[model samples]
Target: MFVECCGCKYYHDMPSNIYEAMANPEAVIRPRGNVGFTGALSMTVKCPWCSHEMSTKCCAGYAAMVYVKERLH
Candidate 1:
């Protein structure tokens, strides 16, 4: 599974255990950040194609596609 860059919409691979991390109640990726290009957390991610940074807390899966799509507007 992977997340898309908010800048170029390029799909970047997520950490193999990201879903697992999300399940941890103690995990705190924060609601926003800009550090997912190389070392991605459960929150932020950067664009590999354009280098644009954006938050990924709410758009981490297909279930959130509606919310993520709404954000594009």
Candidate 2:
């Protein structure tokens, strides 16, 4: 999975265990200097290429799609 940075337009490859992390109730990734909830279904991380705060909606969407596919299969 990849996330696109809005500031620099860089594509970031998500971790393999991202779904597991997101599913964990205690798992919360907050970017430095950022406060408040990013979104109900999203997390925030710094862009490796540009140091910009990026939302993990792409990762979340990918996980949801994969979960649905697994359930359907």
Instruction: Specify the highest-lDDT model's number.
Output: 2
Tell me the deviation in Å of residue 40 in model 1. Answer: 14
- Considering only N, C-alpha and C atoms within 3 Å, which residue pairs clash in candidate 2? none
Off by over 4 Å in 2: 16-44, 57-73
- C-alpha lDDT of all candidate models, in order: 0.49, 0.51
Which tens-of-lDDT digit does each residue in 1-73 have in candidate 2?
A: 6555677876555674543343352466443344564643435366667776555443332322333445544
Give the clashing residue pairs of candidate 1, or none.
none
Model 1 has a clash total of 0
TM-score, per-candidate, Cα-based: 0.35, 0.39
What shift in Å separates residue 23 of candidate 1 from its native position after superposition?
12
Worst 10 residues of 1 by lDDT: 58-67
Say which candidate scores most in TM-score. 2
In candidate 1, what are the lDDT values of residues 1-73, reduced to their tens digit?
Answer: 5566555666655554454453352454443345455443453344557855434454344333333445555
